[model samples]
Target: MRDENEMEELESVVERMQQGDRAAYEVLLDRFQPSVFRLAHRVTGSREDAWDVVQEVFLCVHRRREELREASRFRPWLYRMAYCQAVDVVRLRSGKRVDAWGDGEEAHAAAPEAGPSARAETNALADEMNRALSALPEKFREPLVLATHGKLSYEEIAGTVGCPVGTVRSRISAARQLLKERLSAWLGND
Candidate 1:
């Protein structure tokens, strides 16, 4: 679970982003791009425009964030925005809306061409993590990334989730427990 301080940081970042602060937007982008890009890539199945969808998400947020009054809900609200943008891009491109969480076989079909050993290690890790992360429900996965990978605190996660702090803690706890049960064998008990 997350601590309580991240909300302050997120609030400040959101304030800066709302003020047309390019630096602040850059910070937000840097912080959240992995999860955002992963989500976009999973949805679109196009490595090329997965980046495009990420850009569009922020652009749309920049354009419409002013409409939101509550500062705390910025996190989840932004994700919802990104989700809509990614889906729209996919629909427009493929002439069909993909309802799956990721592209299935096509999702990771664009593996980088590289030496066999290097690719093997990277792909092995990717395969395990992707499978574990994707196994969790969207509710769990979203908060898990926000707390661990994004390093957001419980209060901040609550804001993003529009839920109580307790709920954030419980969900993150459950997510970690599940991942540990599934991954601890490979990682060892250390």
Candidate 2:
């Protein structure tokens, strides 16, 4: 979710959008495109599919704009929509029940100022982390990603994930514990 000031601004934009203001919708798209894309990519594990999710989500939102009752809650509502769409894409591709979670570290890797050896090490660590994250069960992975990468508050994560706050907290804690165990050797704690 956005900061307090941004949230207030977003509420205003959402109000205008609900009233069928195209420019307001454009502002919303610009502000949230990166977040939506990142969530989609984290869930779908493919940039192409993430783009598809973004388009599909916004289209759905636009079509159902009037269904939105509270503009202040738009962030979680958007995330919920994106999550559902990404899950649908994964299900279609795999023909199985699994939540998407993978490969977000590439975007946050160290800058090019790092030496070649350092860069290689960073890349290797990132790869290992991605693998560990992807291996987590859906219940744990979803909450972890929403909290850490999505920067959602516990309450917001609960709303988006359709779980109670306690459940969200437990899942995030368990996800971290599992990741630590999986990466113990690489982290030199074994």
Candidate 3:
């Protein structure tokens, strides 16, 4: 969570961007691009699609900079745009064959010393987890991803998803329950 000072700084940056400050826009991009990509990836379940979404999102931000009336609300507004853009990509590419999980490059990087068997097991588990997540209904999946990967608060997610905070809470809880049920075998609960 950002402190009060950080939020104020972001608000100032957003205001500057709205006022045509290119430097402020660059700062926003540098700070937010990675998170936007991760959020897009989790939503669309395709790295390529995520990249596409990120491009579209920043473009939208640049074009629609003046649409943001309250600078303090920039984060959720930006997330909403990214989320909607990712949903569009998913809808457009629904039938295309793409990797449902990202390449396990990050996982491999984290455990470079692991033996071959360990890596294989890790990859298998990650594949299963990804499959389970993909199986979730979009309503549940979106909020869960926003919370876990995007690291948005319930209120922030509510604003991004245009839902009540209580609904966001319920959806995230339901998503966790569903994932647990789907992965019960791997969890040794079967």
**Runs in model 2 with CA error above 4 Å?**
1-4, 95-124
C-alpha TM-score for every candidate: 0.57, 0.81, 0.88
The residue-by-residue lDDT of candidate 3 on 1-190, one tens digit each, is 5698899999999999999999999999999999999888876778888999999999999999999989988888888899889878877988753233456777799999999998998888888888898889989988887888777899999988889999999999999999999999989998
Q: Write the per-residue lDDT of candidate 2 for residues 1-190, one digit (tens) a residue.
A: 5677887888999999999999999998998889999888877777888899999999988998998899988988888888779878977887432323445344335365677777777767766777788789989988888777577899999988889999999999999999999999888988
Best prediction by lDDT: 3
lDDT tens per residue, model 1, 1-190: 2535787888888888888898888888888777777766765656666789888887877788687787667776766665556657866877543322344343345555656776666556555765676578767776776665445678867876678999888998898888777777667764
State model 1's lDDT. 0.70
Model 3: residues with Cα > 4 Å off, grouped in runs: 95-102
In model 2, how large is the Cα lDDT of residue 90? 77
In candidate 1, list every pair of residues with a backbone clash. none
For residue 186, model 1's alpha carbon misses the true position, in angstroms, by 1.7
Q: Where's the lowest-lDDT run of ten residues in candidate 2? A: 95-104
Best by TM-score: 3
Q: After superposition, how far is residue 134 of candidate 1 from its true place, in Å?
A: 0.5
Candidate 1's C-alpha runs over 4 A off are 1-49, 71-76, 83-122
* lDDT, model 3: 0.87
